[model samples]
Target chain A: MPGDDGLRSRFPISFRFLDRSRTVAPPGWSRWLVPPAALSVHLAIGQAYAWSVFKPPLESALGLSGTASALPFQLGIVMLGLSAAFGGTLVERNGPRWAMFVSMTCFSSGFLLSALGVATRQYWLVVLGYGFVGGIGLGIGYISPVSTLIKWFPDRPGMATGIAIMGFGGGALIASPWSAAMLESFGAGAGGIATTFLVHGVIYALFMSMGVLLVRVPPDGWLPRGWTPARAAVRPLVTTADVSARNAIRTPQFWCLWVVLCCNVTAGIGILEKAAPMIRDFFAGTATPVAAGAAAGFVALLSLANMTGRIVWSSTSDLIGRKNVYRLYLGAGALLYLAIALAGDASKPLFIVAALGILSFYGGGFATVPAYLKDLFGTYQVGAIHGRLLTAWSTAGVLGPLIVNAVADAQEAAGRSGPALYTTSLYIMIALLVGGFTANELIRPVHPRFHEPAAGAPAAGRPLTTEGRQS
Target chain B: MTTEDPAATGPHPTGETTGETTGRTAGGGRAVLMAVGWTWVGVPFAYGVWELVRKVAQLFAG
Candidate 1:
């Protein structure tokens, strides 16, 4: 009878009791459940990485130039950052369910509209459907599950996020093959691309809904078993106060991180956007003729590295601490770019390793950033801050490709050959990474003025009122 | 499942129920809606795969 009571008490159907016991709850709602919810949104929105797949088709079908065809994808990324920044507070307020639902609706509709545009032979329709409308979905869906996972596994925030963020990277892995098959089956003209878009809208809408339905916030005050507030508070990395999303924008830390994210992303994407061309240039003089097939494999391998680094490197941050982890990312990333600039076609292995390393940092930057926010600001409103920080990504989305393409275009016009096209771009990325490294070093603890007073506890730190002015 | 267990006293877990598992009783509509919800999640992911493959092939072809 006594044992029964204990068993009943421990395993009470109502999660309310589990909160009180505060001991480790038997892996609350299968950890398995968390990944699917994250994957649903990430995998669906990940279509961004595969945007190049449509680039060729759109250019030919619309008789548009490369830059013109790229406009939609570029605009969609811009929208992603803007929407995520503006909608972040809304996402936090409404909960993941509402956020994901909206994402599904917008993203899917974007596709459906693109289909119509394709059927009608109107390029603007494709842009409106895929770029503007769907971009809203990409932004919203991207951050929808972040706060929830942090809430669920306060113990392992980095790994929890890595699982979902990795899905974003992997989405391309799945989509590249599948989209090709559909394009082949349907034909790669405007009609074929449009059909693919329609199918993507319908399908992603369906997939993302699972996350909306399954996600549940932990009851307030629920901490993992064996975890205590005192211990959680004591970590040198943890900040206890909540920063209003508005005020977060005013802080130097926010801008510094913005620069950090933008620079890191711009550096990586500059290479990624021009992966095949960069490789071709590197191997141009070799007898082997870097086959187009091998170049494609190189891209896929880069994706794998990107996805794997998100999980592996970010999870490692949990051990090394967020700031230190970023030091590695930026500091080493600059060196990698330098290696590429110096190596320039002479050594294939060095080139591959350097490129892969840079791409890994690119992905690591995304995955590690949320945890960094959690460390600097408390979990109080990290999702919103994160959403705000993503504006940098939108900026980088434009800047990264622009720098690479414009530079390459100019170099090609000058009849440059054999890695000269990218040398300047690589040096620019190195400067950007160095700047980011400096910003990382400048990040000290959140100023005392920013600390939120604990309930019924006297505030311990100096007020932050004057700190923002100093910056 | 009486509510006397001291452990149950913390802030109410969002979806906790103190009573017996109300065996297959309520919210059939909600359940169906959830099932439909999951379907929405799968379609995009499937499409993403299709798109990824097509692009990789083109990269190779060119």
Candidate 2:
């Protein structure tokens, strides 16, 4: 058949195994296996969050300024957005195994390069290696499994995606302590840092290989045992039709979602980036001042909430519908931010609860988006659409920290302390969340003009689903 | 076409019990692979969660 044989003709024998046709799951090959494959990559790449574990050590050991030390992570975020936006289409064309392989190579090799840079004290090389190279791995690894999981678990795309994405949230949880221990063992000097990076590169490469070896695309038209398209079609936003990633971008629905994601992420990340100091500052003037260790614990709590939210809220979206869940995220999220801004240290428990709520919404926003894309655009190139959407994350990554840190720095310069330090930033987050809530409200069903023509219909816009393209 | 070729057969008939039970009926080897796959990812994830939980405990203790 052309599906299998055509790929063989295009690629050399050695590389042909990476083709889409090569990864098709065999009959009755359980779809459950795909999530673990995806998790392996996500868990490995998620180490990006633990970049801070190395930041202090990098600064002290290399005698660099704090801002200089942050360059590698900042560059990596930019690369992640850039690569995901640009490489998304290529990823769709290549399939999951190929993308995972590329991700594993770039991510691990990026770490190795950082090790080389650190060992030689060439900081630019570290930025290039970890930020530029590893960032590409992050972007590709992120979206690699999204479309496949949606395809495999059409019955539970939200939960399926949440399973993989929760790994991303949880990745740092594993890396932070592990990296700290490694740094402790090796000492925090240049030699130790280089060795730590080298070990991370090697270990992550081996761990990510599991994803490459195990990932398989569901066979065309493969549905879960009892589910049918009609069941899904009952939801107004859920479409039985497919839309190309190209056409999806042109639609207002995509842009609305872009704004929604950007705002939601900005709000959540502002607090997350400032969690430790923010909490301490909030209670600084109170009778019960938060200690340094307690602040670290608070940061850990937010991470837990972020990881847990990915799974719980996303799975809830399966029952309540994506729109309603996002309504809760944006609507209720804005209120929580407002609560923090106004209440401040008046109630410590309230402050912690509200911040955790916002963090959970942040993680949920990341996890639930691919499934939301599937609902709006169909599964044809949902991963690519998701890839495109993640530019919003990159934008918010910069915007969130800039808003909080800039404001806090200014407040401190003005001699402000306690809750006053972050009040302006908290209010800004509330406004952003309200904006996100408006954007979420504006989201409507995507116009059918963008939908790919059904098989055997007039070849109007683009090819139909992945199944149609493959056949 | 190969027996595994899904395009050849198209969508399975609705109400067919082909997914979960098929894995069970595939016998011990496939089940063993499933166990190994989940454990490989699960163990590290569990450890991370445990470590974080310990850290979070310091918050209440403080």
Candidate 3:
């Protein structure tokens, strides 16, 4: 009878190996193992960046328009936001292993479905499979390792997250060339595209499985060697108190962060979405006109900047504090936009340097926000709160392209050429950065009302169950 | 499950279990895992960056 009570107390449900309870690190499990586990899922899902490599082939092979070819990518982005927001609480409840498993399933299956669609010449199926199903994988996979890494490496949340996020940014670097090679070898026809998709699905599934298997929740009271609560709370914004994701949405600080993320992303994405053509247009009339190949190079350079900034600037946040790092992102970002606007193509070096600076801040902004969320809100439901905050990214995804594309179109219609076409958009981006800077200034800590009482006291936010302690 | 296990304690309280005290698994396998984990993600990432740097060189060469 006592054994039965002990057994019931140890594991509420029959001890399944895959349970969140089972995933708890067995004392000596090296915390170093966690980041790579996080990176596995992130790197695999980050292939979302290479969606463009499929576009041209898909359009030609399927006899679709440019806009139609783009539907899958757009829907995927939208789903990334939606699934992250809605699935966040569940992710927090289920633990990283479960989330990673679900992500791998959805993501890999998305590729398989796309293969079927391509083989059958059903374009709509491609949209449904790659855009919707694969997108859920992207969303869930994106946040899976976030809070776990924070728990394991509270001393270096910024750096830990930056490492995994950098994987996402760099994913395209691998997928782009790899997919191109596959298309080249596979013939770029429907059959070839289908084979490529099939291969991609199988490969990514194998890759992401590493994360699902390797990820572990830290023990309830585990702290890094020499790290303590007082040490972590030395920062002005870093809170020792916890905030539930449900309560986080109600706070003004959350909205302020939302504005900051949306604005920073909008400014950066506007330039990124049109990086290749923008550089060419900027120098079209100059003595040194940028060639098409050079423009492609510029886009590649921006990708490098974007990828590196996630690690570099986000790691910098650890020493400088999240607020100060963001000050650099917004304030310096605004100044860079101003420099680009004023310098124009008068100096190619100035233009390239300024764009790179702006892009670094953009990638830094994405990589650092999770740490920022952990700072303002506590680690309790930080992943869930992070998931909800991604809605800002979705909003900016639409807003950024619209502002840049629309302004350029209007300028072209009005007989503008070269730098003239983008001048208004640049200025508009500068204004948005200024607004984001103001929002960054406005972010105060979440109020006590929003804070989830620590495990023992009357459950303030949610029930203080196993899920509550899992964080 | 009862909330009594030190493992089930609330989100990070002050120092309860430091990494030094928690018996570390000392073996070749743990070392191997650490190496393999980093290598698995590291190789592909390095390849990606190398490919990108080549393209980046083209931009500067122009």
Candidate 4:
């Protein structure tokens, strides 16, 4: 009876049971071990961002239209959201090790399938393989380390999550140049692309295996050195009660954040998907003709900005607070997009700076949201909630490209040129950013109805009569 | 008896609880494996990407 009471006392909320049952590391083990475990998975699956590097080759080799070539990347994004949302609860139940292992399998297999598709000239296979299967990996791998890292570094959740999230951004830095070289060596034809896919499958599988093997949950009753519940308890960001993943979806905060994330992503990805073409169009009539290689470099530079922003801006959130940081991202991001629209390609420097700024905020939005969720929903079932929220991302993945591409394609058909094509699209992104900013402003403290009462309290004020006890 | 005294407990006389020891070892193993494993995993991935880039450049040049 005492042992049962002790265990119950240790976890005031049902969701905290997951945290309570964890296995804590020994005294001698360094905390530094956590990042690599995170990086291993992140670095491998982060290849999703680098898909653009393959766009040129795929376009030339398959003789596919631009929109046609984008299907794989766009669909992969769609799948990433779907898989993450659907798999989140399972991920939380099974633990990071299980989730990451599954991620590695799906992602690598996706590559293998895509390789076969390319070899056989079956374009649909590439979409099914990379977009559907590999996307499942992206979603799972993305969230696998989140709950674990938050648990391991409760004292510094933002910093811990930032380190792992940074890998997602940095993944492209390595993948871009490497993918280009693979295309060069093997030839960018179907055969060459196939070989590259084969290499990606084998390499990422091996890399991600490290994360699967190394991940561990902290032991019950273990707190980070020099920290306590009492200290963490007072912060407005800390949640004393746990919300089940199911009840979490019912909360207004969840939907509000969902809208925020979706709109923010839509705005950023609009420019990103069309960065190369947009740059060329912006400078076409000007004396300064943007060369193809230079435009490619511009895309690469935007990628660097995106990746670095994940680390720099998100880590900065720990100091300024999540809501405040997002204010900068959404608010300033709208202004930047407006600048690009209004500047009319007259000032190349302004265009580049604005584009980079928007991309940075885009990447920062991803890296910061996990920590933001931690602040709102207690870590009890955060991975699951994070997963559900990713449905928004899936929506944006499709929506962003469609808006940019459809608008541009339409404009081209209408015989527009020299910055005219993207003007309407830029305005749309600005509008989405404005909508996101409004949602961020609307986020209020979660109603008490959502909180699970502390253990031993009479459940009089229970939020939902049925799930209230569980919350 | 003092709450701190393991001998005073009515259960097994062993000084250490099974949970305590198991937790320690498992945590330690995970830490070591994670650090060393990531290094091993990262190296090959880095090399693979490097190889891909080298090849792509060659294709363009030749």
The Cα error of candidate 4 at residue A105, in Å, is 1.5
Docking class of 1: incorrect
**Residues A96-138, model 1: lDDT tens digits:** 6667878989889998998998889888988998899989999
Best by DockQ: 2
A1-471 per-residue lDDT for model 2 (tens digits): 113334344567787778877787765566778888999999999999889899999999888999999998989889898889988887888789889999999999999999999999999989999999999999999999999999888878999999999999889888988999999999999999999999999999999999998998876677665678789878989988788788888889999999999999999989998899899889988999999999989999999999999999999998999999999999999899898888978999999999899999999999999989998888888888999999999999889989999999999999999999988888888889889888888888877667876766764454433333544
- Winner on lDDT between 1 and 4 is 4
Q: How do these models rank on DockQ, best leading? A: 2, 3, 1, 4
Model 1, first chain, TM-score of: 0.88
Off by over 4 Å in 1: A1-28, A60-63, A189-191, A232-235, A287-289, A413-415, A461-471, B1-10, B13-62
Expressed as tens digits, the lDDT of each residue in A132-208 for candidate 3 is 99999999999999989998878889998999999999788989999999999998999999999999999999998
In Å, residue A219's CA in model 1 sits off its true spot by 0.5
Candidate models: Cα lDDT each = 0.75, 0.87, 0.86, 0.77
Ranked by DockQ, the better of candidates 2 and 4 is: 2
Candidate number that wins on DockQ, 1 or 2: 2
Compute the interface RMSD for each candidate structure: 8.1, 7.1, 8.2, 11.2
RMSD of each: 8.2, 4.1, 5.1, 7.1
Query: Candidate 4 docking: what grade?
Result: incorrect
Fnat of candidates, each listed: 0.24, 0.44, 0.42, 0.04
Best by TM-score: 2
Separate DockQ for every predicted complex = 0.17, 0.30, 0.26, 0.09
Tell me the spans in candidate 3 whose CA falls farther than 4 Å from its real position.
Answer: A1-15, A457-471, B1-26
Model 3 steric clash pairs: none
Q: Report the Cα lDDT for candidate 1.
A: 0.75
TM-score of chain B of each: 0.40, 0.58, 0.57, 0.45
